[model samples]
Target: ALYYYADNPQRPYDPEKAKQMLSAAGVSNLTLKYLIRAGDEVDEQTAVLVQQQLAQAGITANLQKVDPSQEWDMTIAGDYDISVNYWTNDILDPDQKTTFVLGHDSNNNYMTNYKNDAVKDLVAKARLELDPKKREQMYIDLQKMAKDDVNWIDLYYSPYINVARKNIDNFHQNPLGRFFLEDTVKN
Candidate 1:
């Protein structure tokens, strides 16, 4: 349970509520541009699923396939209305993900451009916190705040997998999906 918090916010599926909210806001016939990276079957499938879900909520998402080569530049520059993407934390640290992706001051804010003074303050404190428990609590608080802000929506996390020969001894993949082969020996 690296980053599991018992009180984490839960997003229950409520398409009716979404429709009601849109109606209350006087929004009708709403359509959004959804960016999907081209040449990825998984991404295309995900986009289709998301499109169907949004249609259920009375919102139309116009899918646009962007070339993988230019998707990063376009997404980072806030050029799209909505983009489907994923982030992998190779470092396996909450700070590594939060600082760059969510922090307001970070250059790699992932096109959200979300600015929150409280988030910035917490990030600074967590960075300097020596106690692991306190630091974890700080991150938990940040996560709660992030959920409330709703700047980014996390769909799902996919675990990294590796295939190797049975004779490979001590070949273990770390939590971050990194392989340290130096200590591994073949049988």
Candidate 2:
């Protein structure tokens, strides 16, 4: 798809390239800082991995391990150039990403100050559109924009829980919406 292709589907990681971009934008030798939870195993490991990756690219990244209690507050105070976190969608829609993904948004969904006008327009169009084809195209456009913009590097989606009891009958799951016990009554 055009969206996936535009994101430089096969570019190797390079920090010099990243540095040059930052320099051009008046952000040089950017002492990129990161705030992570002190005891979370995933956060701990990821911070170490990023520290190594950025080092390969010639970027000085500072990792500050903070208490989980202070994580949100520190991030809100702009205490980091990057922050490691997680999210679970309430609904599977692009609009949900808009309020959270675009630069320093109220949702502070992504702390990276990445902003794209085209993406905003596309999201707006997608929201108002009822046509499936048009809506899908708009999303494709926005996703492509994200790839090129390098605003956020979507790593991976975690697994969700789906289990059934031994006596349970015909259980179904709606991936895009929440599950409620009341909605799971058996015949």
Residue 129 in model 2: shift from native, Å?
A: 1.1
For each candidate, C-alpha RMSD in Å? Answer: 1.9, 4.3
How much lDDT does candidate 1 score? 0.82
**Residue 146 in model 1: lDDT:** 80
**Highest TM-score against the true fold, candidate:** 1
Return the lDDT, model 2, position 110.
65
Displacement of residue 7 (Cα, Å) in model 2 is: 7.5
List candidate 1 stretches off by more than 4 Å.
1-3, 185-187
lDDT of 1 by residue, 1-187 (tens): 4565668777777899999999999999999988889989999999999899999999999998989878878877777778878887767667777788678764656677877888888888888898989988888888888878886887888888888898888887787767888879888
Task: Write candidate 2's Cα lDDT for 1-187 as tens digits.
Answer: 2122243454567877877877788874656778889999999898889888887766777888889879878876667777877776677665676657852366454656566777766667777988877777777766666777777675556667787867766566666546655556544
lDDT on C-alpha atoms for all candidate structures: 0.82, 0.70
Positional deviation of residue 171's Cα in model 2 after best superposition, in angstroms: 7.3
